[model samples]
Target: MGFSDGVIIVLGLALFEIISSIDNAVVNADVLLTMSERARKWFLFYGIIIAVFVVRGLLPLLIVWASSPGVGFMGALTATFSNDASVRDIIERQKPILLAGGGLYLVYLFFYWLFVEPKEYAFFFESHIHRKLSFWFYAVASALLLAVVWITIRINPFIAFGAVVGSTAFFITNGFKHNAEQAEKEIAHSKMTDISKILYLELLDTTFSIDGVLGAFAFTISVPLILLGNGLGAFVVRYVTIHGAKTVRKYRFLKNGAMYSIGSLGAIMLAEAMAVHIPVWTPTFITFIVVGLFFWLSARELKAEKIIA
Candidate 1:
């Protein structure tokens, strides 16, 4: 990539990272508010780092490595008889698939953030709001994921693109409004327990970091660059979470705005996965619109609160 292309990619990745992480900030604030200040700081720092590096970066690399022969310790054994083609060809062909998967993940993440209302963890059926899948269900899901990755690796690009698009459609149908409202209500509830809230926040952060890690791959394979992007993005998001949490108590509209921004990102990611071409300016435009609207709404709410006071 040229300097200009590099700049565009970096900025695009940063914008996606920021947008996707907005919901994470809101979720973190809900939990961190209950922790001691020192604990909160520790959680913010370590949590983001782990989410970015371990969960997002290393995990995906492991997935790719496992699915590809000769990328790991089994290399020598496979190398003797494997005619599985060149590493460069594998990387080049897989690039689109990786991008597509990243896009689909973005969409699923959007629905998860927007539509899947955070519920209390329950060991029994009575306490469950969303139906819990059994261990077998999860095992099956994991198998399916592996299969998809394998197929993507071996199949024609058009077929892979179609499958990605189809998945995106299924995810987008889940929508965000219902879950967004539920999260807002939960945040407002006096009975909201801290531990559960913290867990939810951690999960959200991990989800948000997925795109950042994947997008970093588009830049370079250097683990350090990936770490740098993840670290910087996580730091900025933590700051946003802390400040937003402090202010959101007084300006509830900000939380709503942030969630909306996150939802939009999810949408964009899904679109990108489907190979839909969004212009470079689309994210910035969406950010400005959401932020401006939230600011106006927050001002109104603040004024009303002041009047009542």
Candidate 2:
């Protein structure tokens, strides 16, 4: 990639990470409210280190290594910047499987929000779908998986297996999130120790980090770029969590924008996995357009509410 292209990809990845983690930031802020000031400071300090370096930095490398073990761990780390054609070939061959898994997870995440998760209705269809189709979420998800696996199995059984693993990861993380929500409620009222609260928050961050890490793949496969963009994004999220959670909550439709961009990226990844041609910049382009549109709508609504008040 050219310098400009690299710059764009990094920016896009950072934007994606920040927007997608807004909810996580909100949750962190809320939980921090229950903790002592000292604990809060610790989390904001040490917690960010773990988040940026361990979760955002290493997770991408781990995913790459896990997907292409033949490349070896160090090889996976430097594979993106390597001049060796053989390493490049290994990565290229593994891209489809990696894309398949991550794509399904993202697509399912979007649908989960649309169908089952409670939210402010950004569009009319969201409310209607939530009310009418919410009960069928499991059925829909199952059928989608069946169809994906059936088609993928014909092309490559390993790809189909990857899709299955992706869906499994989604449900596993989904369960953690659901439990975290319940735990957050409990933590708010109960006399949980500051240390315990810190631990809980760290665990929560890890669960939330999975989404950003996987989504980063859709933006770029370069582990270094992913680490840089996502690390910067993590810092931005921490800042927002500390200072601007309320401001962010006011822009209610921003989450909607994030979800839409996620769904778009999921589609793009799936298409690419199926050997369809997509421009390298398509994910970034779609993300900017979708997010920009929703942000405008959010600002308009916020202004209207302020005027009424």
Candidate 3:
């Protein structure tokens, strides 16, 4: 890829990561309010290293390496940048499985938010779906999984398995997230030590970071680029957690924007995995447009609310 293209992709990945994790940042900010200054400082200082290098960096590398074990860990790391056709071919062969798994996970995430999670409605259909179909989230998820697997299995059984893995991942992480929400509430209200809260926050951060890391694939398959983009995003989230979480919370429709961008990315990934062609820059541009539109709506809503109050 050219330097300009790489720059755009990285910027897209970073923006997507930042917006997607706004909820996590808000939660982190809430818990930090209960901690000592020293504790907050330690978490912010050391936590960034873990969040950036360890979680954001290592997770994608691990995903690539695990998917393409033939490409040694180092090989997988450099494969995207490598000019060697053989190396590129190996990565190409494995890309669909990786994309399939990650795509299903992402699509499921979007649907869960639309059907089950409570939110300030961004569109009329969102509220209608939640009110009437919330209980059918599981049924919808199951049917979606079945359909994806049945379609992919005829073409490639492994791709089908990858979709199953993705669904499994969604359930496992969703359970953890539900539990973490309860934990965060209890920790916030209790006499938990600063050290304990910090550890809990770190764990929570890791869980949340998974969404961004997986979504990063929709932008590019390059591991180094993923690291750079996601690393920058993690820093932004930390900064917002410290300085701008309240300001961010006021723009409520931003979450709607993030979820919709996620669904778009998921569709892009799934289509690519099915041998359809998409421009390398498609994910990046689509994300920018979707997020930008929702941000405008949010700003308008905030302005109207202030005038009323």
Predicted model with the maximum lDDT: 3
Question: What are the per-model numbers of colliding residue pairs?
Answer: 0, 0, 0
Q: 1-309, model 1: which lDDT tens digit per residue?
A: 366544454454454455446555666676567666776776777766776667755654553453343456344223323544565355444445455555444444434433344432222441242354332333443454455545654655543653455356435533443454356446534455655555555654554454455445434433443454555666677787888656645655554454455556545544543446767546546755875687687788789879999
- Which pairs clash (backbone N, Cα, C closer than 3 Å) in model 3? none
Compared with the true structure, the alpha-carbon lDDT of candidate 1 equals 0.52
Reference-based TM-score, model 3: 0.95
List the candidate 3 regions with Cα displacement exceeding 4 Å: 72-74, 77-85
Q: What is the C-alpha lDDT of each candidate?
A: 0.52, 0.87, 0.89
**What tens digits encode model 2's per-residue C-alpha lDDT throughout 61-110?**
88988888898987876775567778878988998889999999999999
Which stretches of model 1 miss by more than 4 angstroms? 2-8, 59-89, 108-204, 211-226, 248-309
lDDT of 3 by residue, 190-231 (tens): 898999999988888888878888899998888889989988
Best-to-worst lDDT order: 3, 2, 1
For this target, which candidate reaches the highest TM-score against the unseen true structure? 3
Q: What are the C-alpha RMSDs, in order, of all predicted structures?
A: 10.4, 1.8, 1.6
Clashing pairs in 1: none
